[model samples]
Target: MSESTLTSGAPITQLPDDYMQNPHEVHHMLRAEGPVREVRTPQGLKVWFVTRYDEVKTALTAPGISKKLMGRVRHDALTEHMVFMDPPHHTRLRKLVTKPFTARRVEALRPRVEEIAAELIAKLDDGDVVDLLDVFAVPLPVAVISELLGIPIDNRDEFRAWSNQLINVSTPDEVQAATSGMADLLYRHVREVQAAEPDDTFFSALVHATESGDRLTTEELVSMAFLLLVAGHETTVNLIGNAVFQLLRNPDQLQVLKDRPELIPASTDEFLRLEGSINIASFRYTTEPLELGGVTVPAGELLMVSLLAANRDPERYEDPDRLDVTRPVQGHLAFGHGIHFCLGAPLARLEFDVALTQLLARFPNLELAAEPETLVWRDSTLVRGLHTLPVRLA
Candidate 1:
């Protein structure tokens, strides 16, 4: 830890532009100082940022640290979702959707995911510079999740438009409008499905779901659908994009995976650890005053673990900054930890493993078409992905 950095808090806004392209450097600076520090989000909310790996694992499951910040959060649609709820509520909601999101169910989509990737890659036959994020990474997950959830194929663009607004904090109108629109759509769908008999589709599954005896209410159902549909694809889209970006930069590692295509699974985890999609875990507040990472964080104050930072913590993984595709990544927090661990992890991993392998195989000489310095990154404190990845597949 440096003496000067200890005195001056690291401002999230003033982080170097390189931090946007690759945030691990900024994360390294914060982790070097200590495990946890205070900072203001782009939204101007003062919050404690948890940076170390061990501390993050502990904080994620801390009883005093909770996700139930009822009135504190502005977005009500997201409020009733499992990610935002504490225990009983979250547990109940999760159980209903767990059946469809199980490992077996996700694996069943293997052929479908592979087919989707192959179909998308087949379109890139024009040997020209194309934005992979647009033609590949972005569409693949949206299509897969929408299919799994029985969301109409026609709704993908609206979902993306609304979801983009929902995830980014810059556009309050967009976020609000998106949330409101999703609420109506999900609620209406739930009711429509419930009015008739249910099917095996995710929409029908939730509409008729019963856990031990209790069922998700209209509000809870609406919120769950919104969260699942948005989160289902958003992170994976970034996962696919981030993996390609890292591998393109580290050609040796890329070739290692290319030669042994079996290594794409491990490489997915490496990318999650090295350049994870989420900027930070969603909001958690201290349920009661408690000591964390040597700091006495008072109750009701906002707290979050930098998922990307913890994954890169030197204390947890050796050469954490380097991208090693063959490295073991069994317990990485990219899918998070504790009761709130991502339910869609199975699906996300399946998507990444399938998409990356197919894309690499399809474009044997794939490389960044643009200079690295000229790349544009999406501006969101919560997501880490290139806005567009221009690549040459020839």
Candidate 2:
């Protein structure tokens, strides 16, 4: 094993070289050792990695922990969103957009979501080997979110590239470039929407949305748009991708879903529990010294909650590693817990249900095109998904 020195001059353990490809083994080791372990991320940042389910919930909701960036990392347009804010600020920002993502609103979007999924699936042909991630997973959510936000569809490819760089383990330079590019594009788009007549689109409503006569500022709108556009699609993209990948790997589980299509909605939680999109929750820091999983972490230290690890914790679920579509999953940290729980959860679930239902019905014999061991996972601590999910649509 290798070590790296943090800015505090303390030695930190580096993650295994193959950590991204297969993190479960490492997570199993970490959970057994203890809930919290200090380690260096693939990007070379040191963090207190929370592995077990119980400790993860504590880290997420503890009053002493903070989401405020506070200059710990470079601040830019991306940092302006509610995910980085705490309390009153987070509350206010979330309130403005909450109505649009409510269960009723999301359910109302079902037909449109189904239409988009069907349109994408129609492009594929039987007996064709294709990168499912590229042709299906990525575009479906991108199109849905783009239309909802009233953003033009012409720049989706650019949006995907920028979002990938921002979400993945990129250097400061890469992140800055992506941040600048996305900020520029969204700023212009937001301005266009702001100047136009009020409309029913979510972005327009957000621009015109008022809570007690309060509205999002220009910078805030850009940041919120950035969050919605990127996160709005990214999570669902991986959710669909990971679900299909897991189903392909486990034939028995796949057959269960094929035989009982009604299980698809319930299976969404199982897929999320097994391999939800985001690996680690976003960056969080300690406000003061606090005990986490019996380990005392100092103030001003970085902490990361492993959503991926927490969901598969043996103590939390029986046979956690096994992919059982019928498993009753509840309180999984896949969508996170507490105030920062994903606002897009409802939409993501709806999209998964539509995507998988149409997908399986249209291509009942779908199978993986590549060997299981050969697939590559994205090199990202924040996002957990594949670089490509090659599959045969038969």
Candidate 3:
């Protein structure tokens, strides 16, 4: 469909303000306009924003299209993992990486994860205001990923800082600079670990895979490690931060969790649905002409799926705007759909469940230190989350 077909009030390239505050209005507009509409990023990349649930499903799992197109389209820095690959290659790489992220594997770190959270909470002054993001959200995921990858505790801070800089959507130059620094760090760290001949860690496991008949290239290993380290924690940090922010905004829901801890698991799902951290889908390219939402996407066009919009699609969920703590939002696209679904989803859920449960139990009197509108959010079209969530521990 032509750009003019949609409302002239809605710009073709830039994301509208309604998308930031209440995206349902824009989703309704796009859905009414049709499923696949011509949109462009601020960078001026022409893309088809998939709005409807059924159309998003089709685009994500559609044949002919491959995740590998990411490298083809923009091969500047993000040159790693099955996240940018498709089918056989994606399948193989995902299998190699998935071995260590299994429920048993991730759950094995529960005690350590809880210890980290407890330590963080202990540092907060009782009845004193604190930024949940600084005190909890950011560190929890960094610690978990660092421990899993055998990164030295001393280096954890550096890693987290670099990851944030690398994924900074507000500025492309910062992302590029972070990419270069991360690449340099990756090589140095890989060499250091190789020389040390460390015990069984995720990095060591990857080294073993490379040495074995599996034969992963050195470049591939480096890229894979970077991908895992960055992608591993970024989304989860936002998820935890977003959950705490939402709960603080709605004290009734916080009390609900405080009263019945059993709801932690279900509430985690609902939080992801309502304010799911990962807001935007990765760029998907069309392999051939395909009909969707009454528009045909010719071969080789880029498709940008709005995961945030799809999660709030009225057709999929009743009263999509309301945040019902008890709602069963199991099928939400927060972690995405199909083969490219998040591999670390289970671990993220576990972290949120444990962190929030323990957090509320520790500080039942928690409240926002500042108004919700005052809280600053990370301004990136890719991932959506708050930069800081000020709160009072009282």
Candidate 4:
């Protein structure tokens, strides 16, 4: 194994309070200092950081990097989804759910997504100053995913509570509790699903999905539901929330988008480029020793890419730090790359586009209700998002 140039215990991506509020500083540091660097995590384990766009893109699809578990990590963490698998198994698991998440299926939900976004706006009308994350950004995506999966609408509150802890938990105890609780709840829901006759719901389709005589086992089915319910909405929750946060913070951009409402879809791409919900891809174990960004990454070592840093690399984007909704924003690694590219990108884009458009149309005078300094962010290593976005509508 090659030794790292970084000093022992030096931090990689995890940073101070200010950096949490504005991570572009860290991204700048990553870009200016070392595109391929190493540092100790809060957990004290050292890992390689790929901070440049070209290097990150190459590493994402590298043959020597496999997404399958290669260490002491628990399987319960993946929730039995394809996001954690290498191909053949990953391909099989992803195939069962691919048709349901195709562009057509997501497009079919756009009208309903509009309905949900509008309803959420109407509900927020009672309060002049409100937390948009609570009333709009969070619920709109959850509602869409829940409805898509045919989950009963009444269970949303409970589902959201469990889902939040799983995605943003800040402690080890919270992780154990959230993991065990979600596993139990989803398993029970799966049993309930299997005990009944099938229907046209996505959950039912997953339960019955077969290919060349292959079918999802009960464990796999539950894991699939758990993955969809969490990943399906979590990333989009941040996607929409982060987008609205960006537009509101950048008034010039906000007014531009408001005047040209059709730009909302394109704006989502810019927002993803800026503050993508997923900061790092799932862990990839090296299949063979590889050279990455001038450093030798030994075989079997765990590696992670900083999508946050990569998307902001000045070498990859002109004026990369500026938030331009109209920038030609393709090729950003917001939804990731390679065989594991996000299955829900179409759904997420549609939801954000609808939500931002309806929000701007309904409250043309919307403004921030809280000081940007006081806003809190979820303390997550793999995702970047605000905990709440308070706004005023007039």
Top of the candidates by lDDT: 2
lDDT of 4: 0.78
Model 4 TM: 0.92
| lDDT score of residue 36 within candidate 4 | 72
Q: For residues 72-172, what per-residue lDDT tens digits would candidate 3 score against the true structure?
A: 64574348677888878877777777765567877877898899899998898787877788778888888888677766547666666677775555366
* Steric clash count of candidate 2: 0
Write the residue-wise lDDT of candidate 4 on 121-224 in tens digits: 87767348888888888788888887787665476766766676766635768767777877776677777878889887767777877888888888887788
**By summed lDDT, which 10 consecutive residues of candidate 4 come out lowest?**
1-10
**Candidate 1, residues 224-285: lDDT per residue as tens digits?**
87778888889999999988988889899888988999878867788888888887888789
- The lDDT of each candidate is 0.79, 0.88, 0.76, 0.78
Which wins on TM-score, candidate 2 or candidate 4? 2
TM-score of each prediction: 0.92, 0.96, 0.90, 0.92
Q: Which stretches of model 2 miss by more than 4 angstroms?
A: 1-12
**Model 4: per-residue Cα lDDT at residue 321:** 76
Better of 1 and 2 by lDDT: 2
lDDT of 1: 0.79
Number of colliding residue pairs in model 3: 2
